[model samples]
Target: MRLTSGPAHSLVQLDTIPLGDWRALCDRALEPNGYYLPDWEAAVNASARGRTDTSALCVWNDGPPARLIGLMPVTSLRRAYKVPLPALVSGHPYGTLCTPLVDRDLAEPAVTQLLQAARQAGARALLLRDVALEGAVMQAISSALAREGLKPRVLQSYSRACLDATGDGDDMLRDALGPKKLKELRRQRHRLAEHGPVSFDIARTPRQVALALEAFLELEASGWKGRRGTALIQHEGDAAFIRRAAPALAANSQCEVVTLRSGDTAVASGVVLRHQSRAFFFKLGVDERYAKYSPGVQLTIALTRHLCADPAIASADSTAAPDHPMINPIWRGRLVIGDVLLPLRARDPLVELIHAALAARRGALDVARRGVHILRGLRTR
Candidate 1:
């Protein structure tokens, strides 16, 4: 296989080598971090399932014991600055606080070499959006990349609250709940258990994850998400990928998937990537059949309580829609935040103008909503 970058601080043109040798690559690269998991390729493939422009960039050292310092998920496009860059960047899929996973020892020269490859590949700017600003590794990455003259912006406009799950069920609950919510949840617990005993299960292998996913699909299909074509299983590859990924990612001591079941059936499930005290909620699928019982809400309560029981798990992260009501209440502290960062270089002036116009269009819709609200208020008065 051809090498992308090398020693002596020499930068080679980075072209993506195929996945022919990824098994060996991942065997060496898979740890708590670094971008060699099957899921990385799977995610790229998932995007490719729809678009043709996305490309996965992997840059590594050349030698007997070669190591990868960085992998940037960039897509080639003719629009901006001419270089390919990440699609869901600023740490894709939320709450990873992870990069492609670089060897700290070789990070500087390797990233410099990596950036050289990025430039040669036609990228103008590197965008790391929706990221945390205070973490140690991130600080290191920021400093190193800044040396290359790349801009890293820290936006305080958004923030996320994560739950700590290390104590014990009660302690976890105490931390995860407020007085009002605690009482409401206690009532929910009583209501739910009356129908049947509610329980939680943890799945750790591909086979187990697959079965869990199958059940999740069935439950999800029974819900409105299936009608809207939003079920994870709607796309066979996504189902397969999640099944493939959850197990592999769970291998990390911090990685775990929690399930809340009603008797024998799963009503709610959450995939959390526990890294350095943070339980990043990777994926969640709920059965709405128990909507009256609010199985999902109850599950979150149980998980939050369970998480709050463990001190090792500092946070139960809900890296979902910022405005999502379900997650905002589970955690008591804000560890991170997110925003959709749009790339500017890929668009022409006309395209930029159109996007700007779209923003105005959305503003008009918001105003119309307000007007309707006012009309209702006036009629009620």
Candidate 2:
């Protein structure tokens, strides 16, 4: 599909975009994570109960055969910054790393049109949150903004923990954790084995996933999350979303359930979502009773080895917070994540003010948090 000059973009309802076109555009995008997948989006909608603000900003080729080239899912927000200024945000809060599904070959034109269409739809600004600073979407947005002479202000920026599994997982682990640390980890595993026969299991088939997921939910609920009242079972919508989405992903061979067992009981478990050569370490839970043995870390080690040995997987994205206590030390690699406020038009005073306010607030919060961290470190020392 070639862009032939004139107006080639419009805002279409999410349900209106054809399935084939939606999936094709998603795959064509430089980076397509599990969170941005069409099914995942549907799962998010299912969990949304009834929020009518959702829509897709689409870009297409004005040709003899008009074809969809790019898409960005957005929801309208009213009364942002205590004012009646309407703004657009990509995806729901639960869904992180929202990026437009655009063909890289035509990224500049597609993104330009996307911004124009969004602006025309009464969106004062595009408040993209939890965006990957070094991702293809960010790159495209930067290029598009530069081409159109628009300036995008950063609301905040931070690093996210990730794992580069392109090389041997064992080798990567060995390098990251020195020989002494590796020996200590092995010893810890041996200590864990003293309780029972320890093993790691992977569930790929539908039947296995169905059964393991129940155990996963149970295990997750039995840990700190349950005590803190933040477990999936505590949130009905999240549980429902996982139940519907995981099976669908498994049916397509895109989901993997991994569990570390102490004899017949599950001690640690995690969910992995795969798309092409990329794998996302979505979530995990540990058995609190076995906290002394560090079952979660043990399971992560097994997972690293498993992913590294597999020829199909090129990388494993931690999908974890930047300073995650457990995964960061194990993975070491970093993913650049940021929040960028892009003006819908070349000059929008309201948008500019809102962006500046958000940036200032985020900066102050960061400094305050850093001060607290420093005080805590000093106290410990």
Candidate 3:
């Protein structure tokens, strides 16, 4: 389907994105973030059953065969899940990041068109949540909305830990965890080694990822996440999603599975998704039996060193919650993530009410998180 040009740029719904154009956009226009990959989107859409249907708005520069500039996935919420007003969000139940697929250079025009089209398309509030604050998406959205006389409310903000994989290995580790902590970690490793030789493996080949994934799922299922029923293997859809996505990612050398073994037993395992020079540490699990020797931290240290030494990886996202006890201290680098609420209707009162509710929810969550941190500190003391 050909897109007729709007006043500034052409607007097309994602379903209307011409055949083969989605592949081109993913290949050429997007950054190497796995969440933005076309395959990932397909998987998310395939899995969307009960919660909400996935929707997207595509923006293009005016052309006979219009040049695609930006694409953002959004879901409509209308009197569903207790949400009173109609809303749009750039995330799904299974996905992590919410960055738009826009060229950094064409961000302004693309975002301007996107916002205009989204409003006209009957979105009452545009929810840009779980996205990087310093990324091109946030920058473009902030500027475009401000210029359009829209003041986007920041519903949530937090510092997410990440790893600079391009740095000198020794120096980076020293700065991140400190010498004393490293020494303590080393001592812990020595204690674990007394049981058997502890080995770390980074699985890249299809066979390796396949094998490591099984161990990973099992290890994850044997932990607190499993007890809480939040582990990937515990969720049928999430488990299937990983099983389907990991191999495709490995085929392109975009996936890595790491494992820490003690003799014949797997103690800790993790999954990392790569795209170009960036990697996202997706998830990990450790045996509760190895808690004393800190197998999880040990595995992370090994992965950190491996990432730092790898010439192909320049950065690694922790993909962890802000103030995560396990990853925060180990990865000193931080990435700003925030949720922004943009009004979709002209002088919309529903947007304001939704924002207020969201703000209240976020405030309560923050207080609870602080309480958790305080309790953790007390426990440590």
Candidate 4:
């Protein structure tokens, strides 16, 4: 499908978005979202299941050389949230943090146009999931909504682990984890070294990243995720996505794979993505055989130091779940993320119905998940 040009906004298929315009938007975006970068998003759309139908809601500057001022990948509400409403929801970008790319200079107008575009698409509301609730982009959206006698309602919110990379890495770690816990980790490291010299390795070049990613996949598949059939490598499409995305992003110095090794044996590995001055720790995989050594935590510790030492990086998003046991204690900074519902028209009755449907769906899913957990626990006992 070709990009459909319009006066202000157009809904183009995700894969059809112009690369040059998308890259320009990312460069001048009010905030950085590595997952939404063209290379990563394109890879996901092409190879990830349920993502092939994704479309990009674009707001343009309509210049002699048209500039993309705002871009968001979205799917219909029924497809994404099973809500029977005339709304669109942000597509999952293979990772959390779906804040849209809106040019900072044209933010207010770009957002106003985006809302209009959604309405033109016959949507009564626009749902943005996993967005930075307090970020500049959200602020612009809120302002735009307010001017039109509307407001964004946060459907759900949580504080996730993040890293403030400005200060000394060692000092930051010490402060976050405390001396006693640090000592215990150090002890674990020493014991891990008994197998061989423990080392942290990072793969930056395309070839290096590709090789490290294979190792990461194998490690992830050898653990609990594999047992549950949820490892990326377990699915052909997901495996293809990371395989394509990692190397492409690495070529631009936008991605890397970090591995923790005991001598020559890989114990833990993770993929990290970069955009602007911010980094995203995408996913981590560990070798269960080395569980006692806490290889995953060890690798994260090294990653922390590595990112902190980088002069260009200002912060890192863990991209982990709320209060993740592995990362929360190590990265003390918190980023408030949430799902926001943007009402497209003032006093629209459909907006309330949409909100209620979403809330009820979420509540039901939570209960089902808890029930599953209880059943598993009982089985173990």
Give the number of the best model, judged by TM-score: 4
Comparing 3 and 4 on TM-score, the stronger one? 4
- C-alpha TM-score for every candidate: 0.70, 0.88, 0.86, 0.97
What CA RMSD would candidate 4 show? 1.7
Ranking 1 against 3 by lDDT, winner: 3
Candidate lDDT scores, in order, read: 0.53, 0.77, 0.76, 0.92
- Worst lDDT 10-window in candidate 2: 76-85
Q: Over the stretch 198-300, how does candidate 1's per-residue lDDT look in tens digits?
A: 8888666655665665676677666777888877678776566556656666554534567777677787877665544556666677877666676777767
lDDT value, residue 187 of candidate 4: 100
Per residue, candidate 4 scores C-alpha lDDT tens digits across 140-161 of 9999998988889998999999
> How would the candidate models be sorted by TM-score, starting from the highest?
4, 2, 3, 1
lDDT per residue (tens digit) for residues 1-381 in model 2: 111223587776676668777777766776766776666666766674442335778889776567777888777544223334557767653445666677867778788888888777777788776777888778888888887777777767778777777888888998888899889888888988988899999999877887788888998999889988877767778788778777777887888899999889899999888877778888898899989888899999999999888888888788787688988888888988777888766777888677666666667878999999999899999
Instruction: List residue ranges in candidate 3 displaced over 4 A.
Output: 1-20, 29-32, 48-52, 64-67, 79-81, 93-95, 360-381
- lDDT over C-alpha atoms for residue 245 of model 1: 59
RMSD of each: 6.4, 4.4, 4.2, 1.7
If both were scored by TM-score, which would come out higher, candidate 1 or candidate 4?
4
What is the overall TM-score of model 1 with all chains considered together? 0.70
lDDT of 3 by residue, 206-323 (tens): 7888888999999999999999888878877777767776776687787889999988889999989886678888888899998999999999999998999999899988878889
What is the Cα-based lDDT of residue 64 in candidate 3? Answer: 75
Worst 10 residues of 4 by lDDT: 1-10
